[model samples]
Target: MSKPLNIIFAGTPDFAAQHLQALINSHHNIVAVYCPPDKPAGRGKKLTACATKQLALANNLVVEQPVNFKATEDQETLANYNADVMVVVAYGLLLPEVILNAPKLGCINVHGSLLPKWRGAAPIQRSLEAGDGQTGVTIMQMDKGLDTGDMILKATCDITPSDTSASLYEKLAALGPEALIDTLSLMATGEHTAEKQDDSLANYAAKLDKAEAELDWSLSANVLDRKVRAYIPWPVAQFTFIDEKQNPQRIRIWQATPLQLAHGKAPGTILTADKKGIVVATGDGALSLTSLQIPGKKPLSVADILNARGHWFTPNTPITGQINE
Candidate 1:
């Protein structure tokens, strides 16, 4: 048994929290934890603590949530920890030269996707959207540049056909801790050499938002289905329809499936809506709406939505709005 190394963990979100839990379970000398400050969330509009911050507070680890790490005051705060190493995961805020140089072993970043690919925000979603067959976590020695850090460990995970963002995220979240432990174990033995990422193969996973989440009916059913999966749990795919008073009722597409429909019908055209579901013709095929959320009502299954307000989306009805560019 070797002596535990002091670690300063920095991250945000549930994915980061998952890794922190594993570190605590392993009983490392966690000097302090760094995470983002609480932000307004939910219907109540109350300030909600970040996932990592909440976990740290519960575990009694010192928590730091600074506006910017580059500030002299913030750097002083981080240096006070006197940590042996720093671990970062989805920290959102960038690490500056002084802070990165503070820890004896430097900072290790547990990125969602393999380094040199999906190297920015929304990695998980972008991987699925791009139809990548596989993705994994990469533990790297952090640097000033984006995710350009040298790789300490690489672990792969398969992307299943039906794997949604939510499901795959859960799988990857578990993998991060195991990989982190292995990297740290090797580091302890002084046998680990961080490998440089291939810059030529790099790709950026641009941030996603409600604007990109809007459905483009002109796209094929397959493409739309991917969007639905990629944007789940945030900024879901949506389409517009005319309501009773002719007001635009934007429906958030929660779940859908692709269908082989002979197309020639205008994209965004509703082909039918009986009991099966709303079969909407696309540019190349059709999509079956399994679940959807009307603008002001709760999310409803295709059957339920049709039962309550089927008149708005009748068969052969044309969907309003231009296919989102």
Candidate 2:
């Protein structure tokens, strides 16, 4: 008969915390939890515990926070746990080969995307930005290369037209923990198979940057729409324009949609501004900015913003949406 495994769980963010919670509820024994060291956050700059660390403390699990595995003491501390397997989910620190091989079953990961499709730091956002029809969770056997691991299991979900990075994140969050628990169960019963990834099909998902959020008007409305959706809840899609005051003003786009119509105007020109939407000309089509946020104000609908600041988005004006950087 198969027995539950001793797991050493490593993770940091809220997504990781969700998986940890699942493991805590499972039959497996969690020997320890590993997360990065606390760091300053928020306007106050006070030290803050990551989601994983807070959950570990709440569950009274052993928590390890080594800066890195460079020190022999840290590696030895991990080795002493004698864990059967280590589960890693969005743990920021890179584990050295020695630490990776510490557990009896080595380490496995709960990656946000299907293996080889989107591999690296920002898989969730990159998948959405690429306009992928679907994306899913991959339970991968940890290897030395970056997300280049054998896949033990994959559970897919569609990326709807209305889905943003944040919404896709919620979907994967719901799918990932269940997949991780299932992988563990299969491993316990010796029923799991690991499949090698086709490197030729791999697409590296580079980390999100604030600079990438700049709305380049030259791009097609379809491309810009994807970017706007992908950048939400982080560096919200933004564009600059010379306001009526002649000063450069930056506005963040919260919600927008691509219109198939063309206005024959230069890219970034404001075609129309009304209660329906703020229609701006793009390289191929137009984009209707439905929700937006300006400096010192919360996000508001175009109708509400127009009621008070209609002059800010006057028609026939050109916005500085060119990607200079």
Candidate 3:
């Protein structure tokens, strides 16, 4: 059995919380947890604790919410922990060299991608958008450059045709803890090896933007279908259209599928509107919008939406939006 080591955990959000929870259940000692400070959220704009902070506090562990590692005092406090190692997962803040070197074994991170592929802020979503066959958790030895770390361990999971960002997030989150614990065990036993990442194959996953969620009818149905899956639970796939009253309104498409229509029509034209779905023409194929929502309303299936507002989306009506290449 591997001996327990003093560990400092740093992360934010639900993805990070799963890793922290696994550490708490392990035999190792979680000396402290570092998370982002509470930020205003929701309609009331009240300050809310991050998932990591909430889990740490519930387990009676020390929690630190430092904005960054630039301060001398903060550096001193972190060094005082005398942690054998620091484990980071989805921790939004960048670690300074001083803090990284302070830990006995240096800092390590549990990243959501396979490294050298999707290495930036939104790897999960980027992988879906790019139609990658698979993605996984990577345990890396932290370095100064962004995700340009030595790989310690990895565990892959497939990106299925039916996978949305939300579904893929859950799978990666569960895979992370198992991979992390195994890496820690290897490090403890001095059996872990570091593999350098190839910079030539690296690709940056730029953070998602609301602008990217706007559906462009000019794109192929397959591409737009992937975008809808990629942007779920964030800036969902959306399109703007002038309603029956000639008022411009935006609708978010929650679920959709691509289809090769027998007869072609102009892109953005509504081909069919029935109980099954609202089939719209695309540049190369057609898309069946199964679930959708208007502003300030709950999501509804195409059948329910047709029953409520069939007149708004009559056949031949065109959905307008800015087209991007």
Candidate 4:
């Protein structure tokens, strides 16, 4: 049998936590875990541990939450672990050259998108927002540059028509652990091949902005639809409309679909409204909103929303880009 590797697992979010869990289940010796320091979260601003740190603690593994790797002591502490390899997934911190080269087998990362494409902070969301047909996980040999690394392995998945960022994240998170484990095993056996990334084919996925959630009706319905899907479970796609009292109300769109409406109308004008959905005209076509929510209210399907506040979403009302006082 191949010898178990001494692994130092580093990650922060749920996506990273899943990979850590998979490593723990394997026969590899996890020497230590590194995660971001606890940050203030929720209403009371209580300090909250990252998903990876929580998992590592639950499993009784050594956990370290270093804010940065610039400190000499931190560097020495990590080196002391004497890990054969380091596995990083969504760790959200920059690793200096000293830390990167400290491990015997060097550091590797489980990135969310197919390498050479969508290589940045928000790859998953950017892929969905751009209407890409497919995306997957890439096990990359880490380099100093941002996601600029040699790909050791990759596993692709189709982006379905109904997929949202949240859904695709779950899918990729599930796929990551298997690919990571296989890559690590191959590395241990000296069977893994590293493919240099093509610079010409690379794309950067810039971090998502809350401002982008504001729906611009001037855009094509197809574009709007993709944006809605991309922003799910984060800064949700939103639009503002004037209520009966002339007050502006903002509504968050949870679910929507692009449509091919025959009639030419002003974009943002409500074409139809019923229990099933609200169809609004757009620059190219129309968008049918299946689910939406107002501030302080849980998301509800159009049918349920209409049952309580049907008057709020009147047909012929125009959704605006910005709320007017």
lDDT of 2 by residue, 1-325 (tens): 3689999999999999999999999989999999899999999999999999999999999999999999999999999999999999999999899988999989999999988988999999999999899999999999999999999999999999899999999999999999999999999988989999999999899999999988888899999999999998998999876666667777899999999996899888889999989999999999999999988899999999999888777788765533234
Question: How does model 1 fare in lDDT?
Answer: 0.87
Off by over 4 Å in 2: 320-325
Cα error of candidate 3 at position 207, Å: 0.3
Model 4 C-alpha lDDT per residue in residues 1-325, reported as the tens digit of each score: 5678999999999999999999999999999999998999999999999999999999999999888999999999999999999999999999999999999989999999998999999999999999999999999999999999999999999998889999999999999999999998998898889999999999999999999999988799999999999999888999876667767678899999899776588888888889778998899999999999976799999998889878776777665523334
lDDT of each: 0.87, 0.92, 0.92, 0.91
Give each model a TM-score: 0.94, 0.97, 0.97, 0.96
- Cα deviation at 24, candidate 1, in Å, is 0.5
Scanning candidate 2 in windows of ten residues, the lowest lDDT window is 316-325
Q: Per-residue lDDT for 275 in model 4?
A: 78
The TM-score of predicted model 1 comes to 0.94
Pairwise lDDT winner, candidates 1 and 4: 4
lDDT of 3: 0.92
Residues 30-64, candidate 3, lDDT per residue (tens digit)? 99999998999999999999999999999999999
User: What TM-score, to 2 decimals, does candidate 2 have?
Assistant: 0.97
Candidate 1, superposed: residue stretches over 4 Å from native: 42-45, 321-325
Extract clashing residue pairs from model 2. Answer: none
RMSD of 4: 1.8
